[model samples]
Target: MESDDLSSLSEKKLKKLINETQDVLDQLKAELKQRKLDRQHHEIDHMEDYFEDAEHNLSNLRLFIQKVFSEIRKR
Candidate 1:
């Protein structure tokens, strides 16, 4: 009889531990998804800034080329 009681208590403890581990796993999954989304947003913003810098550089180059052509024509 004592052995039977011990078996029942051990089973209950195992079930409780399983439930706690599942809850923790679920929370970790949620946090991981959120972090991925945040990283994607950051990458998008970084790309936009890079494009903007390239556009500004192109505009300056165009102006410089025009000035050089004008000077050549005058000469």
Candidate 2:
């Protein structure tokens, strides 16, 4: 959703969205951690690129989450 669309949501709905986004962020973090651990024990070709992509996506998600949070606080 766009920032404008998000800004239009009711406080209750916004809080729910925030919670859901947080859950997703948590899951991504766990997956990234696990991937790193697994890579350490096994030799996987081109695994570094996978990790880089995952980290990049995670960072974007985090920024989006932060924006949502800031919107919530504005209420």
Candidate 3:
């Protein structure tokens, strides 16, 4: 995706980029799920504490991937 011309990239390079992106996206999904569970546990335990972050992080992660893919496709 770094290249100005994606069509010029070899199949191997494109595949590698896709695989790496997938790994990162998977990690983000896992993090969001874990945070949601932690938040629930905190609510149940009557501790006014969770990770203390909005779900915006998860939302941004998806947006980020969308942007990256869009850029890749546009190239």
Where model 1 places Cα greater than 4 Å from the true spot, the runs are: 1-9, 50-75
Residue-level lDDT of model 2, residues 17-58, one tens digit each, is 899999999999999999998887675677787787776887
Tens-digit lDDT string for candidate 3 (1-75): 445688888899889989999999999999999999999887878643434455358887998999999999998
The per-model lDDT (C-alpha) reads: 0.87, 0.90, 0.85
**Alpha-carbon runs more than 4 Å astray in model 3:** 1-4, 47-75
lDDT of 1 at 28: 97
Q: How well does candidate 3 score on lDDT at residue 15? A: 99
Candidate order by decreasing lDDT: 2, 1, 3
TM-score of each: 0.49, 0.53, 0.55
Q: Which of 1 and 3 is the better model by TM-score?
A: 3
Residue pairs clashing, model 3 = none
- The candidate with the higher TM-score, 2 or 3, is 3
The digit string of per-residue lDDT tens for model 1 on 1-75 reads 376765767777868877998999999999999999999998887997878777788789999999999999999
